[model samples]
Target: MFECFLEIGFEAELNTKEDPELMEIAYEQCKENVATRATAITELRKMIFARGECHPLRTDDEYLLRFLRAREFIVPRAHKLMVRYCTFREQNKHLYEGVDLWGLVKVKDAYEGTMLDRPDTGRLSVFRFGRWDPNEFPVEDLVRAGMAMTEIGLRQPKLQILAGTVIVDLEGISYRHVATLTPTVAYQIVCLMGVAIPGRIKGVHIINYSWILNTFFYLFKKFIPQEAWQYIHFHGSDLKSLHKHLDLEVLPERYGGTYRGVSSFGIWLNKIKKYRDEQFDREMKQLGYVIKE
Candidate 1:
């Protein structure tokens, strides 16, 4: 059974929670080139499935629109990103194998506590990554866990086709943890977080990043393009400084803020673990390959 913790108001506008003007940056391009991009998305959807290697549901207008928003409505860029996302899934078979959801949790585990904690800021999906022991789980499982949450998050009303914020708490990560990010793994992560996923990722806050964190970001930086990379924010241990940008009330107790709900990580884990079966089925259908459950 899935034990839900916090219930957020998904109806809140991004303008109210975040800087109203900055919100335009996410969809300004789409608004400017609406007709052309929409047409291209329609055509590309048909072209992609023609090869008989895609999910019809993923090609739906609302679903594909998220990718367009992520790419600022640039058809080619959006198409390339979609293709890359599908390719990444194709390359990894373990994602669809036995107990992937629980496997991901047991290995690369985490959930969007930021959402449940701050119901008003549900649009900003924040996750804590300090506890993820990279030595036990490779980058593949990392991507699996991230993508699994993304899929589940989309089930929320407006989140289906909207971009959201991503906050990663980097408290306990060490040199050995950062060393695990190889070029291949780095590229995979960038594609998933930066390009592949439809969400605009209005901002990526790396809070509590330690001095040693710079080395990891240095290696991780090469894979991300400048435009998307520019949104990445580094906030050291200063909770007040980080709260200045991200609403202080939206944070958890660790950062000197309160959750106002069931503040247990296990409750958040169940929220994501419930989606494991659907994600595996999704991979099986998207790649045109069948995996016996």
Candidate 2:
């Protein structure tokens, strides 16, 4: 449901100039255009796709590639603005309500490390929603949740060692965060850096589509061959909606723990393992991987 044009415009601006004044104006214009059109464009795309007519944007791969390309332009601009703004505020020692810019950079670095590449601007698009508000910040929630997972040792690689007693708090975190965090903490750190901090600190919405797409891409990049990159896509809705629709039954019984009538990380991890196993199995059937089972 994302638009390619806005992304293209943003990208064009990013590549066209280096002057701070021009960059700021171009970035603001692109941001405004994207923001103004986001909802309508998304809905239109969905409607067109739903009608079963050959939607111009047919696949998630195409959408993601275009989105990433566009973000490559816009994200740097946003990052620069964020850095400047945050520095100014910090220098004045003014109290800011939202996420910290330095925190976002750290998180983005961590995220890129986990993914082995810089996160595209599309991935950091959540910051455009509003002025960064710490109270509404998903980064804090994710950090807290992640810390909790670590505290309970649910984040450990081995699930069978511990029964299903570990509880995962799903409240106050976004679905995008859920997808990223459920992986290794390293991956979670990447997502946290790219999406969560920016969203909180900059008061930008940083479209959830970017997070979902990046998460899939990050996983695929790590576990699959480069030739197979086309298979990855953002699978679901924005973070909040994703959490709402999560199904617990798909996970392994060993990992499934009751948390508000749903599965915890204990269960979620099992599902991820199963997903990996299925992908591996498919790859083995087709390509015959050399690794010993």
Candidate 3:
């Protein structure tokens, strides 16, 4: 079975405005954007698992176990509101479910506990004030735990892939109200393998398009040195071929190609360039203040 969780959270510091019409429009727009992204994620998950036999009307013990494990990591600490849009299958039927997964948990306690217990989980723990804290009960951790539980579930061999977009309103204007506006979208996708053998599991693929975009951003920021940190947007269709390079080693297990010395050297050189440029900008900004006699 394939399962996915697409989450969206809003963080904004709006000025005191008395227009109720504008506020209503902003709220509705954000809701619609989130809903559309969630639907896109559901479609992507189905596409990845189309070859497998989907089960309907069956209890997902493995999924429940992973969910519980995730709860143990995030709840009782952060005190932040969380909503989950989950999709899964049982006996040839697709299931869609949503819940306020962290409603009962204390956020602050959970956040501190997760940071202290990082070694036990073998994952990093950190918080982003406005953005979603993926480290605190992230999808990656859930996939790892769920794959391990597949042995006990006796389910068919399958892979669950998740993909979605993150829309940031650049002008502080909600894109949902603009009718034709397309916000800068960042897509992330992860794949988890289903195994029938107990105590043996593998991560077939865990690819996110965001990485490629990051790589490009690094290169551009290093070589181009633009004044503003502009972002590159990607659509769902732009991520189709990310798995091609890893197909041999990840999927079917065969030799494809190899990287040489020059390629390695170039990668390091680019990283150094980017680091130096960033430092230069910081120093220049600090030096801008001066006293005149």
Q: Estimate each model's TM-score.
A: 0.69, 0.19, 0.17
lDDT values, one for every candidate = 0.57, 0.28, 0.22
User: What local lDDT does model 3 show for residue 26?
Assistant: 23
- Residue-level lDDT of model 1, residues 199-234, one tens digit each, is 556677788776777787777788788787677877
lDDT of 2 at 18: 26
What TM-score does model 1 achieve against the real structure?
0.69
Of the two candidates 1 and 3, the one with more favorable lDDT, higher being better, is 1
Question: Which ranges in model 2 have alpha carbons more than 4 Å from their true place?
Answer: 1-133, 136-141, 155-233, 237-248, 251-260, 263-293
- The candidate with the higher TM-score, 2 or 3, is 2
In the range 106-206, model 2's lDDT, one tens digit per residue, is 22211110100111111111111122233444444334333222212211111101111111212233444444434344444333322212221111112
Task: Identify the candidate with maximal TM-score.
Answer: 1
What CA RMSD would candidate 2 show?
22.0
lDDT (C-alpha) at residue 163 in model 2: 14
